[model samples]
Target: MTDPTARPADPIRPTDAEARTLARDLIAHARFAALAVLDPDSGAPMVTRIALVPGPDGVPLTLISTLSAHTSALAADPRCSLLIGEPGEKGDPLTHPRLTLQARAEPADKTALKAHYLSLYPKATLYYDFGDFGLYRFAPLAAHLNGGFGKAYRLTPADLAQ
Candidate 1:
């Protein structure tokens, strides 16, 4: 038998104005994101949920405890990915729009943004200043947007410019 490989039809559509808008909307409104990073010791993929908010300059930012596994992973390897979007309550979850961002996590100054960050997530004030916690900014390198079935587009950093 011939070698069989899975090659499904390319469902990704051309990047368009609507796709760009949807991607920006998703990125800007995301309150939380699924962060993916490589386990430093094991060299395996790991994912964890993180509270995300827009930084002073509108880049995706978050405060994370240095104790968390994901934080350690980021420290060892800044490469990471973020998935932003939540399925709607009334429809098939698979049909919901979502955006996956490939980014590099960089350390951000906590003191400069402490008050602004807390303004959006007052509850974080409890541990925001903990010595183990640090602020990180997700600098997007590229992104894939799934606007629903048959609605996919690959976007660039500019397309997601806030």
Candidate 2:
């Protein structure tokens, strides 16, 4: 006999193409994201809000200050995650789609990235050359995309890149 209260397994939405596009769009259009890093001393997880822009490889690019706690943590441990997506005001928050990316943060050539970064954040031009600030790229290793109820996918770097 079947258990009446048991919920059926959520089916994967046949929107792989769409999901891939959405994932890339999320990174491209996002102005900010929640960056989670590991604290060097305590080894506890820490999260901070950060500006987001597209990098050379359709990944995330960010400018972080060396003096900040998150930057220091990244220097010690490059592993991090970024939560991208925003919930609509009308729907159940859980029903909204979001992408969680597991990545490694590495310093990029600032000079190469400066113009691109400036185009997105023009105001940053004033402090663009600040010595304490740096350009870092997020190299996605894996990703989990929740595209609403019954819509979920585990994506790899290639999936997102395409």
Candidate 3:
């Protein structure tokens, strides 16, 4: 006889393997993420949905216009957080297996990185006509993934510091 009540090892604490899997999964499934930029004057969070592209290094890249409020916020303070996942139907959303990334945003240099970003999100090319469309790179400082049903993990840059 075995105890069915026994939990399964409390899931794995984010290993390098887990981190890579989570990052890749988010990249593949998510089309957009809510970018949270801090209001420089009030130091409060302001979130907006922005199309995102994954870079070779797994960092997120986005195209934003200088006219947008979020873009203005980013210009004032580059530190931000992004949230991506399916909204839960019940219970706490945070525990429902979502991905949140603490990141730093910077205007991407018009070089290989920017080119790669554009290639990944070709549809965004249409927005270039806006003139204010500029590439912003969101380099991950840390990440947390809660793959519902008790699968949760945390990752930091040091974990992927290759």
Candidate 4:
């Protein structure tokens, strides 16, 4: 018999084909995500909304400003997390599907990504070439997907590979 006070280590379900499909779809179509990083100075968690795009092989990419707090934090510590997917027009927001990805931020070559990024976000061209702006890639480490109420799965980086 188990101790009454004991709790499960993780309530997440084992990954399945359905879960994989949902996770891939979310990552593949995500245009923007909530970026979470540790504040370099205060060590507090900071989250900011950012526009991101999927690159070759579904890797997440973002053009960020060096002056931004999030960028500074990422420079100090590459580990970060991202939340993708949005709630539908109807129903409680909590009842919708969402994905949280764990990743490491790494600097990406601006020249290689500029043209493609511009094609997707034309207006960004105004600032894409700014001296302080740079491109970065989020290397997936792991991901947690909440498909809906009672639906949760833990995914390895390989599960997200395109």
Q: To one decimal, what is the Cα RMSD in angstroms of model 3 from the true structure?
A: 5.9
Worst 10 residues of 1 by lDDT: 1-10
**Superposing every Cα of model 4 onto the true structure, what RMSD results?**
1.8
Pairs in clash, predicted candidate 3: 97-146
What stretches of model 4 exceed 4 Å from their correct place? 1-10
Question: Against the true structure, whose lDDT is highest?
Answer: 4
For each candidate in the order shown, give its overall lDDT on alpha carbons.
Answer: 0.91, 0.89, 0.74, 0.91
For candidate 1, write residues 1-162 as lDDT tens digits.
754786776777989899999988887788899999999999999999999988867679989998899999999999999999999999899899999999999999999999988888788989998999999999989999999987889999988786
lDDT (10s digit) by residue, model 3, range 1-162: 989988767565645686667666775566688999988778888888898877666667777888888888888888999987766688876565577888899887545565676677778666744677777878778877767766767877654333
lDDT tens per residue, model 2, 1-162: 999999987565554788898889888888789999999999999999998888767889999999999999999999999999888899798898889999999999999888889898777788879999999999999998898887888888988894
Clashing pairs in 2: none
User: How would the candidate models be sorted by lDDT, starting from the highest?
Assistant: 4, 1, 2, 3
Pick out the ten consecutive residues of candidate 2 with the lowest summed lDDT: 9-18
> How do all models score by TM-score?
0.91, 0.89, 0.75, 0.92
What's model 2's lDDT at 78?
99
- Pick the TM-score winner: 4
Q: How far is candidate 1 from the true structure (C-alpha RMSD, Å)?
A: 3.1
